[model samples]
Target: MSRRGWVLFLAMSVIWGIPYLLIKVAVDEVSPETLVFLRCLIGAALLLPWTIARGQLRPVLRHWKALLLFTVLEMAGPWFLIAYAEQTLSSSLTGLLVAGVPFVAALAALLLGEEERLTPVRLLGMAIGVVGIGVLLGLDVDGAQLLPLLAIGLVLVGYATGPLVVTRALPDVPGTAASSIALFVTAVVYTPFALPQLDGTGQVSAPAWWSLAALGVLCTAIGLALFFALIREVGPQRALVITFVNPAVAVLLGVWLLGEPFTLGIALGLPLVLVGCVLATRRSPARTEPSELADVDSAVP
Candidate 1:
């Protein structure tokens, strides 16, 4: 990676990381379904012109089935799950949980026979990461909120699976077009549920609205654009390393901006999680085939 690539990579890490805090804030004012709906709607609206101008609408429409599957797994399911989970879980926690995505993708690849056999180190790393997550879960302020944490885990699974779907099913599709159409489909799917929550009873504060706009425009649209560029410049394996940076930013923002408390559990568990991520993502000569699915998982969210 060049200096420019490094710059974009770090920018994307921060851009992607900050959204969790924004979602935490926005969901305070709106329901998860409503936030997801508005986010997809706004993101799709912003990307619509570019998608149209690029003439991808026809191909995307032609492959509607694949597009629908991608949207469901990648956008609708994961987006709502994350939003709903963030209602109770801290954004930093959510970001930490998401750090497991690359490991999940590696497992997915092994299960799908797309990669070399998994090594003991990777297995150990996955185990440590899971234990770290357990520690984080044990630290939850609201113990009865276990189901939401599980929901977040499921979202991470779906997020991890999304890349496999892209590589195995939609490998030829343009990334931007596929992402834009997926957002549009997600917006359409969530609209009915989100609409009822939007009663004309009270107006949202300006800050909340601005948060939503930033979530859609900066986090979704611009974030996705920069991520794709990074993937193109560096291979997916290297590009996926950004996940390591994202959680640090998220934790910092959570503490600094949201004033979320940091605890001994976070201090202890975060290093384990980061170490696990490093172990799982370490490039090895045995697995020399640059992974398309790895790239997909890295860029999925």
Candidate 2:
């Protein structure tokens, strides 16, 4: 990676990582639906004009069905689920759970017929990642907190499947335009649910408000731009390494800022998950799938 790539990588690592913490904060004062709506609304506000100015919106709109799926898979479902999960799950745990995306993405590729050959190493990696999840759950999470695990499960699926949809269905769509439009569509979809909560949002605290603003502008809009550029700069496989960095930042921020608990489960499980991600996403020597990395990369949002 070049200096520019390093810059994007570091920037995105922090940018994407903070969303978990921000959502943890924002969801304290707002419903998950309203939180997601605010995020999308703010993101679209920033990206729409830029997308339109670049004349990419029309092309992006041409693939509305795929774009809609992308919205639901990439933003709508995962965003809400993660937010909802964060209500109970620690921000560090949330980030660690989400870090399992690479494993899920690998499985998604196999299930979708995107990758016909699943190497033994990759399979081992996936198995280890599952063990990590089990350790986190069995040791760290109580039975009462299981619902958050379910929510994180949904988020993992969405995160895994969203990229496959984008890469296979709308590979040619401009990333900025696709992401911006998806944000708009998500905002629209959540408006009905969010409207009822709008009256109460005024009571949200200042920290939560700042967190929401950062979630919308920094994490969603600007993060997507940096994510897309990083994919281009470093290719999908190398660029995906940023996922490893995200959890560290999330855990640190959660511990330092939010004063969230960091336990033995995280200390043990997070390394397993990160190592599994590296193993699962590592470039196979004889790989024939040209779009495997791109497929994983597209789902970063």
Task: Output the number of the lDDT-best candidate.
Answer: 2
For candidate 2, lDDT tens digit of each residue in 145-201? 888999888888888888888768887777778889989999999999999889987
> For every model shown, what is its TM-score relative to the native structure?
0.93, 0.95
> How high is the lDDT of residue 46 in model 1?
82
Enumerate residue pairs that collide in model 2: none
Q: Indicate the worst ten consecutive residues by lDDT in candidate 1.
A: 291-300
Candidate 1 residue spans exceeding 4 A from truth: 200-202, 286-294, 299-301
Tens-digit per-residue lDDT, 38-121, candidate 1: 999988998877889999889868778877877877789988888888888888888888777878878887898765676788
Q: Among these predicted structures, which one has the highest TM-score?
A: 2
Residue 103 of candidate 2: its Cα lDDT?
84
* Residue 268's lDDT in candidate 1: 74
**lDDT of candidate model 1 versus the reference:** 0.79
- Per-candidate Cα lDDT values, in order, are 0.79, 0.83
